[model samples]
Target: MPQTSQGSQAGEGADPAPAGRPPEHPPRWSWWLVGIVIPLVGIAVTVLTVPSQSPNRPPAPPASSSPATTRPPASPPPLPVGLFRLTNADSLMCLSPPPGNSTPAAGLVQGDCDARPEQFWRLRREETGTGVVYSVRNQHTGLCLSVDAAHKENDVTVTQYLCGDENGLFPDQFWSFRYDTLRHAWRLVSRNSGKCVALPAGSGDGEQALQEDCDGGTWTLWRT
Candidate 1:
């Protein structure tokens, strides 16, 4: 009714602010959550994602090696030492190298068991790579028993000569002993001839020792 003011009518449309209050903005607790709590949560996540540190350890040892192998040495033959007599099983005579003939190429013989030094032979065992063999040396004549060179037949002559050495090892000079356990005797076999030293049937004393076939019974067997 009276003169109404336009400015007062415009202010009347809006609500009035409360008296004695500060201007509205974000909450203090929200600023604390953004600056401190949220940053601490991010740091915990980063620490969980990162790989962990490991302690120092020693390296493993190398694999073990195998032990070395050792081979056994060759053994010696079972023959006697010193001088001995070879008594023929068939004739009961002693083998000798031509009594009083100490020279080479003297034929061997069998005679009465007079217990003479010439009848006694010394067996010298040689340890060769092939096998064990013996060189029959006369105690009196100092000669070694042998067979005629390269003769492989029966009744081949067995002789005595100078003992061969490593320089000239005559194969005939080497002899091998074959033992017959049942008869308790031995057979003297020649290396070159491969025959046994045998006595002929019904032969008497002073008969020549001959190389013969390894058969026809006990004529080849000898006893020491």
Candidate 2:
């Protein structure tokens, strides 16, 4: 017997089936193709469109007029760089270490801070009266701290030397001030380990006072 053609077959006149066989349906590829393509497109779009959230950090604060809680201030200045009048126990001049590089050391002592060029002072930094500094200049020598080497604890000395070499400046010559006399007086201070700072002598500069009970005398009466 002749077979009948099915409408959904490949060819217009394609045969659907033989007498006892079921009609062949075209493989259902449209649904499968759509399912694969839709998921693939969706994944591609997600990859291209999403963004990251990772770049914004925080800030810092202004500086304070103080040392850290556990530590002390750094060091003394080169020498008295500002307007100062020396009072070496009624002696009118600011004292300096006696002559050295000669014989047995005279150790660090006070000489008259007079019109001698070696006694005149200028600041280490040009910024006037800044930090813990007061540049000591020699009036007669027209020179500043000329330490041949860096100064150390206790053995520090001031000299009437030229201020050219980097190591010429000693740390002991410069005076540091902490507010005193109800903030009306200024006292010279020193640091032991570059941390804690305190006055070295009593009001008379005898190396006894701890900046707390300085003698109310002219020797320690330093003005800005």
Candidate 3:
């Protein structure tokens, strides 16, 4: 219900602190050299290492857009829903919503393989107990992904919105990266319909699409 992001207040320009009158000089001592040199060294290191959080700098990488692909397909097919744990492992592959575009989500890429927040997901079974589902979350907005009822192929744009309605439910509303779990890698499956939803903007059409009994393409595979 809140905005995806908020602007921050930048530090305003300010005059440097004044150098007050010099106090009586201390008797020259060896320890004085150590104190002065050590402090100077420390200042230099801090200047060289500590980064300033001033807003004047370029934004810090839009807070890592997405997370890494998890799980391995090695023994995928027969595996139970929750056993497919996400990790820094690459035995996994993410499916782009079908049609054309390319480029993995930032968190699931080679660099971000851990349980980085953006890439975190949970596997779930439909409340009706008909099928399983996976969800990819971006904590920043507290939203998952929504579909443009018209998107039936690849290369479509994915927009951010609240995680609700059919978009937040299963069949077309899931992450399909693990093998044997039913949905394609990072694939979307519509919940109520038991239909495999395609993101024409993210990945491709699966080999086994069935006809839809509902308004949208019923190409869902889990139909009994």
Which candidate gets the maximum TM-score versus the true structure?
A: 1
Q: Which stretches of model 3 miss by more than 4 angstroms? A: 1-111, 128-130, 146-150, 158-160, 165-171, 174-224
TM-score of each: 0.62, 0.33, 0.29
lDDT of 2 at 156: 41
TM-score of the candidate numbered 1?
A: 0.62
Per-residue lDDT, model 1, residue 170, is 74
Global Cα lDDT for candidate 3 = 0.37
Clashes of each: 0, 30, 37
Model 1, runs deviating above 4 Å: 1-78
173-208: candidate 3 lDDT, tens digit per residue: 453432324343222444533334322222232321
Highest lDDT scorer: 1
Error of 2 at 14 (Å): 99
Q: Model 1: how far is 219 from its true place, Å? A: 1.1
